[model samples]
Target: MADAPLNGIRIVELAGIGPGPFAGMMLADHGAEVIRIDRPGRGGITIDAKDPLLRSRRSVALDLKKPEAIAAVRRIVGQADGLIEGFRPGVTERLGLGPDVLLADNPRLVYGRMTGWGQTGPMAHEPGHDINYLAISGALHAFGRAGEKPTPPINMVADFGGGGMMLAFGMLAALLHVQRTGEGQVVDAAMTDGSALLMSMIWGFRGMGRWSDRRGENLLDTGAHFYDTFECRDGKWISLGAIEPQFYAEFRAVMGLDAPEWDRQMDPRSWGPLKAELERRFREKTRDEWVAAFAGHEVCFAPVLGFDDALADPHNRARGTFVEAGGVTQPAPAPRYSASATVAPTMAGERDDAGVLRDLGFAPQEIAALGH
Candidate 1:
């Protein structure tokens, strides 16, 4: 919509993997005009621009190996409100598109840099992925079973949670600062820093002596049978998280556990036996049966669903959580507003060099000179 919060905002994206594209997607979802600069003749981790992360944007292939490409990027930056890139600390500098140079051309531009370690750490220039960044951030150490080795949560916590979302937030904040003070700055959004920040609640628990550093030994972890997934008779899984006494009472009543011995819910000794008994009971029914039994009760229950199931879920259908756009089935834009509902994502892999130049008020001859 024309009145969307970021309606008139413009962003230039230096195409990259994972977090970089996701951040740009977030901005573009909220009405930022994000134009991604794809590198010419380069192979990507995947050529699937239809992936949800790369949605809701336009693209232009630019070979930074050439001086003309660098000039083109600078020109776009000069007209943009923000720019996002996820290269190592000095890669953009080597390409002459560093924050110093870009900001010189556009003082109100928000230069957003995404990295794994950070810009000035000992490992700043090193190669790393989501798992490596999470390992160093201490967030990966708190997942999985009590005795098993630490298990990573498939890159969501670090990559999308810390890296991409954090960069998007930093870019927005910098843009707000520019609007207020007319000062542009570089937003150094590092996954390592953000992943650690994500663990702030766990760190608080540890500081208060309510949490153990051991993986899966905490209240929120799988330490409590009430807060974990259990296999059902149909080889399906259901999750329960009845942490409070009231919720547990509701669950106990619904399950018809009238035994007085099961009353000591908080005793660690009871937890093991209770878990075994519950496992046996859960095995007596399919996952759907358990979902039905807990439907009206406040047991904090849910059947574990796969991707396709999630898309077809009643709640998801009602909320329009997943949408079909550009021949892709993917998640819809988030944080709904009273007005200006999100636009459907578009397929993005076309080069419009002349149109881009024309947007910068270039004459016909100049636009023709800026060839693809």
Candidate 2:
């Protein structure tokens, strides 16, 4: 951990849910000393100590409604490099820990704000979750079948991808700015904006007249026969992405798709029929059988693994893609570094409140006054 890129950085996290905790986890995984300020009592979507998102951070339970707690947060942030919060707009300002106050206390503090609608839009103060955010971002419209209602990708796109990950990136960018200029700024990371930004390539495709507004009618949205999932004989699934001509030819050659109609690889009218043929062909073999068939081929094939299968997958195991911590199996820290390797995750555990406060140079009397 000494060589970790964020080893010397400290972050104060005003814990809420979802993206805020995820950002803190990303920072903590990279060796930032992320101290999370949790509510004194559990409420909506509480993250238990063993939750992977809470890993590698020390939690301090403080009632932000209390004046002493607010002061304690200020004391902590005054010496920290960054702070993350996911409250609705104006909530932190009401609690007296807004960016203005914290940045005044520490001029180089990168204040990261996570929200679904951003800090200034008309819907900034509205209450919404991942689905609602994707709905507004136009990402949801591109997620379903050709004639089906758009399916949510189970919060992965907006919550973790756009919201939390983008906040982490913004925090690091702002932190870099702070290092260079001895100044800080607010990072308004809105899920809506981030999700829309994620669609840049698709927007470009649309602008180039290669994409349509219709759902699942584009090349990558499962509209093409070569780019969709298929059910196997055993009821398990497999996916294909044989978009390139060579790969598609390999797919057809391997699957015995020698009919004349199968040559129309890019014809929209032939996709539905080709997909039907693929469905029938795939159901002729079990998922494992198909996996074995495509093992050394370049058909862009993979089995759609479930959690247990994913954990036990040979490729995943070889790459150490998942690790066990605190008796729970979860994904490992990603984007591995050659020089600044990230720290292995540890479970969130009980902390000595007074010890933590003392490390922060808080006197015993002051700690007691804060009811720590």
Q: Among these predicted structures, which one has the highest lDDT?
A: 2
Give the per-residue lDDT of model 2 (tens digit) for 1-372: 248889999999998789999999999989899998877655322358678999988777778889988999999999999999999999999999998899999999999999999999789989999999999999999999988999999999899999999999999999999989999999999999999999999999999999989998889999999999999999999999999999999998899888899899989889998899899999999999999999888999999999999999999999999999989899999878877888799887665566778888889999898777
Report the C-alpha lDDT of model 1 over 1-372, residue by residue, as the tens digit: 346678889999998999999899999999899988887653422246568898877776677887877988898899999999998999999999999899999999999999999899799999999999999999888888989998999989888999999999999998889989999999999999999999999899999988887777678888876888899999999998998999999989999988986788776657777888889999999999999999889889999999989998999999999898878898899978887856678766555655666666767875555453
Model 2 lowest lDDT segment of ten: 38-47
TM-scores for all predictions: 0.95, 0.97
Return the clash pairs for model 1, or none.
none
* Weakest 10 consecutive residues of candidate 1 by summed lDDT: 40-49
